[model samples]
Target: MVLDTVMTTLHVLTGALWVGSVVFVAGVVLPAALDGSLDAAPLETFADRLVYGSRAASVVMFLTGGHMAGTGYTFDLLLNSSRGHLVLAMLLLWLVLSALVEIGRSRLVEGLQEKRVRSPARNAMGVFRAAAVVGVLLLVDAGLLASDVALY
Candidate 1:
């Protein structure tokens, strides 16, 4: 029971951090940088700092979530139960989010490294928008999953 509680807490906290960071970067940081309100250097620096934390949180969430799923539900339950369906949806969302973050970051960093000063912001904005939309969707799915679990 204690282990379950701890894993649940970790899973929720890490998930929140991962999603919050993405939203902040996509909605606030990218816009500010593009508009010239925030300088590119500082924005890049801030993003660099966030990358490690975001990735770490993502990994932790995946690990804890997987552990919880494995221990709490059988394969039959996963396929047949409503909660299982929700979990599967959440998992798919998580995979997409992970891909978006990685691909976006890679493109952003590549542009930065290439010193594409004139276009990096514009390019990054597109990636940020894409990631942000997916992140928001993931958050909604998570909320629904939590609500379903609570009612269960």
Candidate 2:
């Protein structure tokens, strides 16, 4: 029980951090950078920090989530249950979110490395936007799983 609690807490905390950071960059930082209000150096620094922080959060979420799921779920339950379906949805959304962040960061970094700010910001904006959307969906999925809302 204690292990389950710890795992759940870690999973929730990491998920929030991962999603929140992505949303902040996509909604706030990227726009400023794209409009020339933000400098390349700051943008580069933010991108690097966001990417590294996200990577760490992703790792934590994976480990904690795996521990919880491994102890609580079986293949049959996962394939046949509504809660299980939500879990699967969360997993898919998590993958999409992670990929989008990485791709967006790469786009921004590649542009920054070239000493160009606005163009790279513009290039990464769409990807980050997608990530933000996915992040929201992931949150919703998690809420549904946690709440009494019926998936069916």
Q: In model 2, which regions exceed 4 Å deviation? A: none
Per-residue CA lDDT of model 2 for 12-121, tens digit only, reads: 98898889999999899999997789888888999999989988988898899888778978988778988888888888888888889999999999989878999999
Q: Which number leads on TM-score?
A: 2
lDDT of 1 by residue, 1-152 (tens): 99999998898878877888888888877776566676556656776776777678778978998999999889998888887887788788788777777766666666666544335667766776777787788778778877776332
The count of residue-pair clashes in candidate 2 stands at 0
Q: Best candidate per lDDT, number? A: 2
lDDT of 2 at 59: 87
When summed lDDT is taken over every stretch of 10 residues in candidate 1, the lowest stretch is: 110-119
TM-score of each: 0.86, 0.95
